[model samples]
Target chain A: MNRAPGLKTYAVIYLLFLYGPILILPLFAFNDASIVAFPLAGFTTKWFAEMWADPNLWKALKNSLIIALSTATLSTVLGIFAARSSVRYKWPGKPVVMGFIMLPLVLPEMIVAMSLLIVLLGIGINLSIFTVIMGHVLMCTPFAVAILTSAFQSLDRSLEEAALDLGESAASTFRLIILPLVMPGILSSFLITFTISIDEFIVANFLGSGQPILSVYIFGQFRFPAKVPSMLALGTILVGVSVVLLAIAEYFRRRGIARTGGKDTGGFL
Target chain B: MTFSPDRPTMIEFRDVHKYYGDYHALRGINGTIRAGEFFSLLGPSGCGKTTLLRTIAGFEGIDNGAVLIDGKDMAKVPANARPTNMVFQSYAIFPHMSVAENVGFGLRRDPRSRTEKAAAVEEALEMVGLKGYGARAAHALSGGQRQRVALARALILKPKVLLLDEPLSALDKKMREHMQVELIKLQRQVGITFILVTHDQEEALVMSDRIAVMFEGQIAQLADPETLYRRPNGRKVADFIGTMNFIPCQILSETGGRIEVEAKGLGRVMLDEDQVPPARGEGEPVVGLRPETLTMLYPGQEPQERAVAGRIDEVIYFGDMTYYDVFIGGTDVEVRLSMRNVPGRPVLDVGTEVQLAWSPSALVLFR
Candidate 1:
């Protein structure tokens, strides 16, 4: 097949448009100037040092880590049960129930945040990191379910039956066969949900109020012109962490496919 | 033919009936599988052959009737507790485990020590001709190797009855034929009753000592391969097993346990009681003869007993044999005659006049 130069140029332009801002973040982070413009400034690690020195940044990072961890664990646990049941058994109103469970994905996050705040306050619950965690879980669960469902769907039902036929009980068969086969799916779900929860802004802003959540804290720091350089450094670190996490997730997913001798269906690489 | 008292019954189904919502999966299934016998449930897809096999394995529940394994009712027994293990159609070799781990899986609850279990897995692998393959990951093996692993894994438990749900269906033709012979030898070596469910008639015929032909959730006929091929009870049974040319015939007279039928393609012939199965329905009786039963008499060759004049309608040349579709005695019904391709013999062309040799005893009359 002949390659079209026009199509190649279009692809290059599209990718540059997508990654251009992300590429500039690191360039400005390492540049020795406060302004994020051209005419390249000299190199410096001082912005990274300044980022590390901020106590509020550390507190916000801790809060975001706590929310991400909790949301990932909670959603993935729920996802496993949902995905397994959806794949294995037929139940009454299955589509409707699964649809409702996944509704938060399509439902506007701002709307979910606003309504959750109203409900929580109506129930006399105070705004805290806990509320923000609940909001994050609701937003992240659909993604967890989507990934886990694919994992569970690819599994052969005969593997479970063969385990039982070989004298293993239901629980033992799950532990020995089912769990190990779908481990990559669970890992993928956890990482994706964790990433989503950490970067989510609306839920954090609506539920946390004055709480030191990373997204909300970052928005506040944008008001200070001097703090933008250190924020760029923080953004560079986040981009690096996300790339590494995604790489690790894709590695496990591919390894799982190889171990099972299954055909490589494309994943979210 | 009923199972005699001399051979002990390993698994018996007494009026077994099962339904899946509105669909009748198995209806009033009654049969006996003899001890140390290679039995097969043969049928087309959705004919409930696999369902019947799963009932023996206790993977399926019977709505009414009882399934007995060694004269013990299996109603309350679960699949794991049943004295049967299955070689699944997919082979179900655990992809994450080594071949040894898969074969040793059934021994997890056994009271044997680790070394004894390892030795047993080794022996089982050897039985299936997969010796020294225990260390290899199951995912790395080919389809044939995986089937062997499944066979070894199922046999490791030494269950009273080994249920095979189309275990060789995944293999290619050559591998499937090879495994068919190996399975027969393995059954004889182990001396265990093996019940195989398959849609392949040749596989069942090649591997089983006795076969139960099923159609529409019922066992149409239960007999050995030769009997099934030579004398199917009804038209449906005759059609499913192998090729049988059905020529419309009229019953001319009925004598003492003898009936003479005037067939359309061939002349009148007398059929003994054994040659005529009991009438299953009120319809015009037809004479069924196998393709190989009708032979094409070549040049300089004589049919010592009997012969019919025929004109070749079509000639299908197989490498070893030639099938000639001949219109016998000016009749429109074309009876197929098979001739061996030997040296100095020529393939017959279409529209060639020929003589066909056959016997009356080989004809099965079905109403």
Candidate 2:
């Protein structure tokens, strides 16, 4: 309530600066004119129609979905193992090993893509959608591990022990108790990794070769000035989809917290 | 003090020893827990009381010796296959399940029909005074309710031994007292061996049929509650269980099962062999006496036993009881005496002269 007026205005300006370009995408996507300049362009649905009718865009979308889903599944599954061990056990040189695993989160994506491309070529491997998936998985696993580790840490150690003591084997205990408790964290990790993989440009461009990836195809579409309006329409739809996906992930995360009677610390809403 | 010869030993530990890294825990433990008896392992923290209980439940393995349950060696059995169940201190009610689900969790592998298993769950809930609570969510229950659910869960299995690891430590004082009586009644109803691990001396004394007093990973003494409080085996055991005033003394003579010692404040006394614990350490011998055994005489009261002249130095008043720290005549030592506050009796002030009366049989010489 006592917020300074100067600081309040600065925060408002800061938010507008961050989201100003995104707000313009929907504006132009529904505008009657192809020109992006303001002057009250009338509303029209032609650009959205054009974006939906493109066969090449549909093919690229299919390829991106396959890579994102595969990357999300593989990274999250591997993340569970890494996160569980890191949270529950102590080992020598663990810091160094985990550092290497998380290095991709901060390392420049272009450098990682270049190194991976050179490695793939040196090994006589052909670059394709599979290659793109491998790159995306590598980039997304660190996020998955970080998220899942917090989930595993919030769980009580005695719950698993109680199940085991009550005549359940170790495997069954994990399946019945551990899985249900951490399932929310797993879903969040998968959604976040999926979002990261779908829009990834550097790795898809470098490792995908001539294969049609949505990000690479969108970049190619920008070469022609006529396709600019339709690209804006596509960007608007993607923004809506991303917002809905985040809302859904947050919903499940909150429900998971409630199911386990845990307090809600801030999550990725 | 007297155990029936017909009651079988339900569990036995023979020279059990355990070590964590370089720290020795559970050093050569040997004891027998009788069938259908309420046994307690009482000790301070890091005394390996919980470790010993866990060994019986198959949660821990001994470095040497064997744990025998129902006269069979349990060295190879895992915890899931063991014939013991534990009510954990935290209650450990599965947060995601209903109360009925949590209670009936152990019954998942039971080959009985669904109706029979449901009936059993209902019976267990009723046994713990949680009737009509099967439909409630586990996380919504209170602390006392959670404890009852945990009890029902462990009891539903009908394990040979029910282990409780400080189950009442989490409750408030009033709730803890209520649960103590409830647990005793429940144990009698179930007719199974109950093993409790607790650091609270009062709780152990109130609930246990036999208590094993552990110190630094070793059983110092195992006896009934009265004997443990009255004739603690060592200085440490006596000091840990309750308040005792130790008077340094000199051993004058030793006869058949009798020893005479000249105590500092209480003068000379003859102690039978049962009244004397095994002598430990060197230098001067000592005799230990409980606070309640020593009494202060009011005006016009004749001493029924031998009396010592003393002056009250400090008065600690409780609502129903008062403890007076009295300094004996011609000695630097002070002894505490607790007296119940009767309606017509007056609370003695500090520095008031009084005669303290005590019996010779109540003194335990520790040399």
Candidate 3:
């Protein structure tokens, strides 16, 4: 409830700084001129059309979609279990387990990506979309787990206990009671992991070969002037998709907040 | 080994002991809760009342001995395997489930068809007076409605016993009063044993058929509410269960069914402690009385016949009764009287000389 002055300033500054560049992507994508530089050129949609016409672009988009979907599914299922156990039980090594789950979030992304690449190479796992999926799953699972752990932690464990006392078996009780209760947190975790997997650059860059992802494709397009605006169009679309996904993520996040009796503060006190 | 079908023994804690690591939670406790009895484990917080209730609910494992439900040992029985259910202190209503879904949650084992289960859910919801609120999510309902949903969910399974952990502690005063009466009626209709855990003595007194007063993880006294309140086992039991005014006294003589005590400040008083054990020739014996049993100060009363001479030092005026802290012969003693706000309470201000008196029978003698 406290509307402390300093945090409000920090929050205002953070929102503008984080969102300013992404907002500019859509504006430039619509710019008519091929060259993306200073000077107002009239608006056009040719780059978008140009991007659609490219076969390579389509293949990359398809590959990214497959990878992101698989990654999200893999991460979400694992995340749900990991989060539930981490929050619900008091195992002897719980602290160590939590630290391991959160390591990816705190560790540098490049280090994790590089380590995964080297580990995959050592195990003779080839560089491909499969490898890319594994990499994204690895990078995204931690985020998924972290997001979900918070969600599960906020829910009262007594609901599950109540269900069990009413004679629902452990497995069915989870399906019938705990899952529904933490669904908002579960969904936000899914979308966030999906977004992270789709938007990831390093793992896809290091692991993808013979199958380039959207991030890799976008990076390749940065060199050619003819491909610049088209890439800008592609980037614009990705940004919009990401924003929409993030917005949906935010929706579920807000829903989870509201569902758990979260504070209705404009900002944290 | 099993109870009869007519008057069943629904739940029994047979020498049950629970330990959380090294700390003993429920000591070798043995008790049986009959079907259709409203029983309360009354105690201060940390007295392991909740732990004992949880052990019956299958949430906590008994470290030793067995908790029996329908004469079956529950030591190895998981919570989900037991037919007993609980309404947690927080109500524990599934926030995601609508009122109907929550009620139907336990009906998964219904021998009836899905449609019949659905109908049963409706019946349970209606039983709790939440008939029309089936579709609304649990979080949307008010606190009282959620509590009913919790009750309905537990009841739908037709559990032999229902464990309620301080179920009314979270409610507002008016809501709690209304619910207490409703709960009694609901229990009568269901005819299942209700094992309730609460620290609120008044709540235990009002709702329970029998109250077990616990102290430091042990049941100090277990009896009907009337006996528990009136003839508490000792000074600790007396002090814990209700308000008491205790003062140092000397045992003058012991006889059948009665003993005379010479209280230091108060005059000779008579007490009945069931044959009055041989007098303790010790540091100090004490006489106690419940505040409600003592009468108020009166100017016209005989000064010499009264228990003590004292000045009323403080007056704590509760709406129903006014309590006076009197300085009787240098020892401060408290007395309470039901107020008749005619000329208002016998306006005894601080530092005022007041002569307090009590009948000899009111002197509750204790060593």
Candidate 4:
């Protein structure tokens, strides 16, 4: 049967409630008044232009870029090796290893962030972008691995065997054939990890020091009302970039899945 | 016990014993394949035909046997390093690649100029009758086109041997027949040893120069298709290769190298001891008759003397032919005969009692 019209209106209200504040941040960055209120005070682009001129903002941006890039590269590489090895051959403790690699995906981020924080402090390793990278890798590696595993599994095993039958060695076959076929998956994994590293706040909050990432910096900017609109402008930019990166990542993911004949959920499932 | 000192043997399985854990896949298989001949390893799925082909292609490693290619031991030879290519059952054409790239992939094994590669790709595509269609992605091609692309990819490399694992199993009947002839033509043009693994009896019969019928990881019979069908080694070979009606029989007497056997359903009849000598005294005697070997006519209507009495239970007319399932002396025997439209023909309907007759030599007596 059909739902009532009131319920549909309620559902729309709920969706607006979720995104209303974040959407307003971009709107008010262009507002004329410095104070962000229900009635947008006036019209101005001073805050957005100032966000560009600030030297510290540029340094913080550079730092975040370095961490996210390293996180994307390192996590994706490690994920590829782990995924390929796990998929191609059956070995003892394979289930256990796979479970361990995937454990971070299910475990609460708070628990993981705190545990990793404790371990670094216990090992006398000072908190920095390196520690932050380690944490991001821990958080994002599972996703990268998960992405590549399905791509590898969806492949026809005979394709590899046919390569062998034609006289390509195991390593050469991987380099020339298997790698190219799953390039979409690898690209998706890289894009996904970069987005996660860029937007992730919880682990970066606890682990970051000396040079804080963009997320922690944004959080630090929340305390001062004078820097409020600038942070919103900055956040507006981050939100836009994250949305674009995530959209690209999702596009690659959906295309990869469709190419491999996998189910497309469109995030509903 | 001298090996061939002439042209190299394309492939050999030397005492190959393969095991998927405890289940034995291949057992002590030792055979040499002559170069440039079409040989088929024909059997049911679990009979290790595909396993044998994969072993030769270096896709599978045996538990005990050595797979040798061109007389060289392929113990540590990985798949790509082996001078053998395969057309897989699914026709593993790279979905992301265009037809040209797929056929040209193996040609990149050694460095070549781009012009040479392009020329070679064009020639290979032309060989498969897909010359100008190289730019289309593999998924866009039809099933038959995909199959040709796979063939071109494997054949273009000029490998020492071409292994086909149930290559035409995915195709429809008409397409399969056309491809079978096309493959044979391609094999003749390329002159490489083509080792086909298939379970389809008609496919094995219609294509291969010689078929090695396997059962339970062992070669049961290896012969040309006609000989294999006509002179099957055992009841299993006879039953698997074609349809033959079997009946329990008792040997009543023996004379002139012929046996008078009393079929459970038919009275005393003389059966010829043909290619397979009838061991009358050993085991339970059985008589096998091809359905086509018997003809049904109305009672007392036989021009000659020999006939078995029967009543037609069903006559299924299938366009060019009709099959009459007849009940003769309490036995249901299937009699297949050609249906030709001639004037004043006998219209034998259901419940029509008739006499089925055949030459005694048509009876394949076995024990």
Candidate 5:
């Protein structure tokens, strides 16, 4: 297929516009000078050392890890139930139920955080890391369900029947056949939900209530000009972690497709 | 076709009925499958053949009847607890497991030691012509190999009855034909009651000792392959089994044990009482003849029994045999007949005048 030279130039410019800011983080992170300016400063590891020394940074990282891990585990478990039932069985109002479960994916994050805040307050619940985890789970479960549903849908129903015909009970068939086949999908869902929860700012800001979550703590650090270089160092490290996580998730997703002998369709990668 | 009539009943369905909401899937199914016999449920799609087979495997429950295996009622039997195994149409080989793991999946609860189970898995694999293939991953195998693995997996349990649901449909034509003969031989070697469900009439006829022809949730006829081909009970069964030329006929008289009919293009003929199957309330009566039953007499050849004058309307040449469509007896009725492409007999062109020889015993009267 032939493409016009003008279209090629436009695509290059579009990609540069998208990724140019992210590319500046590591460059500024390694600079010796604290001020993030154009002229190349001598490379140094001082910002990473400074960032590592802050006790509050460690606390925020711990809190964020707890929230992200909890959200990933809870939402993925819920997603397995919802996805399997949606794919393998028929019931009244199925579409309506699935639609409601997926509605959070499209709802604005600010609205969701605000609504969850109001509900938690009305129920006399304390705002803490636990509440932030709850809000993040609500925000991430739709993504988990969407990923796992495709995995369940690709499975052939006859495999389960064949297992049962071979004298395995329903529960044993699920343990021996269904769980192993969809393990890759479950791993993918866990990684994606963890990444989404860790990087989310609005929900963490609204629900943490000064709990020092990592994303909210980063936003606060930006207010102090002296902390900018260390924050850039942290951002660079985060970008690397997110890339590796998504790469692993995509690998598992592709492996799941191949294991089922299914054609690869669109995925997060 | 070595089925003995004295064999004991393995599975019996008494007034079996199944409904999917408003659609009645199986309407009062009644039949008995004999032990050690190769049986088939043959029908087109949506005819409940697969549903009926599932009933025997205990995968489907009948709404109004009892399913008996070995003279015991199976009303409360679940699929996992039943004494039947199935080879699915998709083969359903577990993609995550090795071929040996899949074949020995049913033996998970067996009391045999590890080495004993391994030997049994090897033996089952050899039974399906898949020895030494057990070490490979299932997803790496081809379609025909997957089918063999599924067969071995199901047969390893030594179930009282083995159900095969269109097991050869996914393979190429040559592979399907090859598997058909293999399945028949395996059924004989094991002497297990095999119940096959297929929409392919030729496959069912080639493999089964007896077959039940079904249409729209009802069995039209349950008989051996030769009886089904020579004497179908209804026009629909006749049409579905193979290519049959239906010629309009009028019943001249009915006697105590004979039926006389004046068939179009063939004049009057006397048929035995058994040749006339029970009426299915179909449209005008017709006499059906298979394409192979009618012989096209070449020039200077004598008619064996009866002959009719026909003009060759069309000639379809196959490598070993040729099919000729001829209009018979100065009438508009066209009947297709097959003639062998033999030495000294040239392929006749269209519009050639020919003599077609047929026997009255081969005609089935359907009303």
Candidate 6:
């Protein structure tokens, strides 16, 4: 095939436009100057040290970790039930129910946060980290269900029937066969939901009342010009963590497909 | 034809019927499968063969009939509680488990100790010619090996009846033929009543002691393989089982224990009472003859009782046997006949005038 002139250059520019800003975070984080701008600055680790010593930053990190962990576990558990029933059984109103479950994936996060704040306040529930966790779960569950549903759908129906024919009860068959086959999918779901909850800004900012959260705290620190360099360092670390976590998730997803002897029908890379 | 008269019944379907929404899957199936017999439910697809097999395994529930296994009503029994096991069409080997784990899966509820169960798994594996394969991953095995594993897994439990649903359909031709003999031997050694569901007529004829041919969710005929091939109850069963050349005929007279019919190009002949099956009102009266029953005689060879003058219209060579479609006796009726390719005999060519020899006893009148 003859190449179109400048196609390669166009591709390179397109990729740069998508990710060039993310590449800038680490560069500015390591720069020695306080101002985030051009002109070469000498290297320094002082901003990283400053970030490590902040007590308020540590508090916010602890709160974010708790919320992300809780949201990941709860949403993945709910996803298993929803995906299993949706894939295996037929019932009245199934499409409508599944549609409602997946609606939060496309619903704007700002609107979701505003309505949830109104409902929680109107119900007389005090805002806390727990409320922030609830909001994150609602937002993350649709993603978990989408991933796990494909995993469950790839399984052969005869495998379950063969187990039952071999005298295994329904529950034992699920524990022995169904759970192990879809374990990698569960891991992928957990990692994705955890990543979503950790970086989530709108819901965490609106629902946490006055509690310290990493996203909200980072937003507040932007008011101080001198604190900007340390915040950039923290952002650089977050980017590195996200990349590693997603890589691990993709690895397990590929391994699961290999274990089942199924074709790699592309997955999240 | 080899079935004895004294064996007890293992499974019985009493007017079973099944439905899937508006589609009637199994209309009303009634039959009995004898103990220690290798039985088959044979039909084309959508003929309710698999549905009937599942009803015995308790995987499917009939709408208005009873399925009895070993004289016990299985209406309330779940699939896991039934005394029957199935080798699925896909074999359904657990991709995540080793061969040993899959074979011993059903032993979880057994009262035996661990080592004793392990020995039993080994014995089952040996029975299926997969003795040293228990440690290998199931996903790595070939199609034939997976079928063997599925067999060993189902037979290890020693169920009263074993159900197989087209277990050899996934293999190539050579492998499928090899497994058919193995399945027959395994069925005999275990002495468990085996029921197989297959859409391939040849597979059913080769592996089953008796076969129940189904059509449109009902049992069209149930008899031994030899009887099914030799004396099908109607034209539909006769056509489905093998190649039968149907020639138009007219009933001339009926006598005591005899039926006189004038067949096309073959002249008049008298048929025995057994040769005339009960009328099914299918179509016009016709006489059916198997291709192998008719033989082409060479020059100076004597006819076996009766002979019809025929001209060879088409010749199909099958290595050892040659099939010729002959237009018999100044008529447009073409019937196929097979002749053995002996060392001294020559293959007949098209447009050759040959005398086709057939007997009156081989003719089955379907009216």
**Tens digits of per-residue lDDT for model 4 on B50-121?**
888878777678889688888899999767677888888999887667788888888776588988988888
lDDT score for residue A92 of model 4:
96
Across all models, the iRMS values in order are: 0.9, 0.9, 2.0, 2.4, 1.3, 1.0
Is model 4 an incorrect, acceptable, medium or high docking prediction?
Answer: medium
Docking class of 5: high
Name the top lDDT candidate. Answer: 6
Chain B TM-score per candidate, please.
0.97, 0.98, 0.88, 0.86, 0.98, 0.98
lDDT, model 3, position A28: 80
lDDT tens string, model 1, B17-59?
Answer: 9999999999999989899899999999999999998888778
Winner by lDDT between candidate 5 and candidate 1: 5
Worst 10 residues of 1 chain A by lDDT: A1-10
> Could you give candidate 5's per-residue lDDT for residues B157-257 as a string of tens digits?
99999999999999999999999999999999999999999999999999999999999999989999999999998899999998899999999998986
Model 3, span B138-235: residue lDDT tens: 77888899899999988988888888999998899999999999998898899888888989898888888888888787887777777767666667
Local error of candidate 2 at residue A233 (angstroms)? 1.3
Candidates 1 and 3 compared by DockQ, better number:
1
Q: What would the per-residue lDDT of candidate 1 be over residues A1-269, giving only the tens digit for each residue? A: 44798898898999999999899998999999988788988999999999999999999999999999999999999999998999899999999999999999899878888999999999999999999989888888889899999999888888888888888888899999999999988998999899989988999998997899999898999999999999999999999999988998899889888987888888778
TM-score of chain A of each: 0.96, 0.97, 0.85, 0.86, 0.93, 0.95
Computed on C-alphas against the true complex, the DockQ of each candidate is: 0.80, 0.74, 0.59, 0.57, 0.80, 0.83
True contacts kept of 3: 0.82
**CAPRI quality of model 2:** medium
Error of 6 at B113 (Å): 2.1
Ranking by lDDT: 6, 5, 2, 1, 4, 3
lDDT of 5: 0.92
Residue A257, model 6: lDDT of 72
2 versus 4: better TM-score goes to: 2
| Alpha-carbon deviation at A76 in model 2, angstroms | 0.8
What TM-score does each of the candidates earn?
0.97, 0.96, 0.88, 0.89, 0.97, 0.97
Residues A1-269 of candidate 3 have per-residue lDDT tens digits of: 56798998899999999988777787888898877786859889988999999999888888999999999989999999898888887889888977887777778878987888889889998789999898788778888888788778877778878878877788888888777667776777777777778778888898887576888888888888888888878878777776676776677657655765545333111
After superposition, the stretches of candidate 5 with alpha carbons farther than 4 Å from their true spots are A252-262, A266-269
Q: What do the candidate models score in CA lDDT, each in turn? A: 0.90, 0.92, 0.79, 0.80, 0.92, 0.93
- Tens-place lDDT digits, model 2, residues B109-200: 99999999999999999999999999998998999999999999999999999999999999999999999999999998998999999999
